[model samples]
Target: MSLPIVIIGSGFAAYQLVKTLRRQDTQQAITVITASCGDDYAKPDLSHVFTKGQSANDLIKMSADEFAKTYDITLLRRSRVESIDARQKTLRCNGESIAYQQLILATGAKALVPPFQGDAMGRIITLNGLEDYAASEVELKKAQSVLVIGAGLIGTEIAMDLASADKRVILTDRAEALLPSLLPDFVSAQLYQSLGNQGVSIELGTQVESLRQAEESIAISLENGHDYRVDAVVCAVGLRPNIRLAAEAGLKTNRGIVVDRQLRTSDPHIFALGDCAEIDGNVLAFLQPILMSANALAKTLLGQASNVALPPMMVKVKTPRLPMQLSGNTANADANWQVSASREGMTAKAFDEEQQLIGFVVTGSHMKQGFSLLRELPPTF
Candidate 1:
């Protein structure tokens, strides 16, 4: 007779929330509506599955039916939330209306696809979810070489993965270095060289102008004037938060769905987390923040207001060619960092205006110092 708590995603954020909430209140009615197959899998695994020789099916931790039964929650798969009626405390999904005691928007972000000029229908792929990965696997199986656009976290990891699979990989980006937003030139240059040593062709500081269909492969035109014909094309540009439903419902949104420290959106009964949420004017799409938010949101859902603990987060890049660890805030792409490099490894630290330790990067054998440097980074988030 009572409405169930509705979550609008099935990603790690949604899974963790349900797990955390169930720990305190096992009998609470919960429902998850997902656009995908609702399989339980670590999304981060998609990027490096190739290195492990794993398929999309292998990446699945649990199926939708199994997850639903295990958690004792309703799972609506292959469904999309069409709209949200914030005032009515209900949402329309697939032409059906559902009411909720509390609405959690864990919709997550979408893979950003840059605009291309030529015919780029089935030739290009961006792996953001299970289905996308499946589609990419099909393309990669027949392709001998791959062109990866955007040398960010996803781009670099995927390039390394493809190379490990014995595919010729060409990594390109608008920035002069890989992971420009997260690493300084010195740090990225080291990674660039490492990937190069691993047989990856690094194409930096160029824009992809068009994608045309060639006789045997896809023709990619770069703004730098050099052209290439590759068997496959993949884009790892970045992600943009899913804020449409929130914004359409009049919820406050900036870079993401605006939320307080408690993960509460503009509406009292609505909350958001993970890639879709901006908490306290900051949007963090990292794993640690998502886990912290889920734990805090679970407390709030159980009738207690708890704020997520802001700590300097650590991210371990999945490139085995050159292992990397980043701690603290490296959100600024133009940060002036001081770096020290040796054959053993590389270490870079960022400082604030007042000489406070703000961020640092460690790569290769130098990760032994990651735990200590993580402590030195400021909790700016």
Candidate 2:
């Protein structure tokens, strides 16, 4: 009897990796272990909650049984990988062990809950996985007014979803603008105004002071000493990659699990992808990057030693109300940019001193230019 190839997650990264590997070698004895139910689903659908009119149950695209039967792969549903013995190449789980010809860590990231006090016992939710979403959905049903803490992509999306649901939504952030890391000030202002038109309250340049459980609801204390009452609170603050496991195993880690172009970690037999990995200091938290990483890693698993090179990845922020297509490494580029705005949408272009297009943000229907700009962008090595 031979050991199976073990994968430690079922998110976009792990799912794509398994799907690609199965296509190349169906008899590879693959086993997927997930902390969640191992249900197959597009995680990004969580943000499209309002537009899709989906409940927590309806949001799930596929079940574990469906995936297992469809792929003829073994699914260890709702199992936790306690730790990995990298030197011995084994993963331990509940008095049992699994050996792998190769192991991939797609463990993903956890939402960072700020150090604050309040009815901190689950009244406040973070949308990181199915379980978290399920819990949040229940609270959302009872919430007439919702408080969202953060103005980043996830936070803004959730705020829009809640507002679309007719829930009075209040959003706050430490940055002066929404999606500070992804969009320019003017573009963010455009989105802020758009959300306002949709009846969302914005609180930029503010932070959460504390949270307190009021009668039959919660009160969110703001840094400016202002308190707002809301039926539910969602901490869409941000995410930090789950690298403790990899770090504990003596594998080299930086912002994420540092991987080579082949998606191989410091240990040759171990590989990482998704939010938990930082390939050449690039931890892409988008769908396109995840798909690319999966494809590249799958080739390596099938005995092809190929390096994965990425083009400037484009992301559409599912704000159907705002309609935008944004792209490039907007988060890390230290360069000047040009902004063009009209009734159509705003186009913000970042260029290097050498006059190379590095990043861009296109809002509303005017984002059609993204395809043309994407073709002209350089390879993200």
- Quality of model 2 by C-alpha lDDT: 0.84
lDDT for each of the candidates? 0.88, 0.84
Question: What lDDT tens digits, residue by residue, belong to model 2 across residues 123-183?
Answer: 7788887778876786787689989998888899989988988899999998888898887
Off by over 4 Å in 2: 329-340
Error of 2 at 127 (Å): 1.1
lDDT of 1 by residue, 117-234 (tens): 9986467788888889876786687788999998999899999999988999999998988887787777777788889998898889898999999887899899999898899999
Q: Once model 2 is optimally superposed onto the true structure by TM-score, how far is the C-alpha of residue 226 displaced, in angstroms? A: 1.6
RMSD of each: 1.8, 1.8
| Residue 26 shift from truth in candidate 1, angstroms | 0.4
Considering only N, C-alpha and C atoms within 3 Å, which residue pairs clash in candidate 2? none
State how far residue 50 of model 2 sits from its true place (Å): 3.0
| lDDT score for candidate 1 against the true structure | 0.88
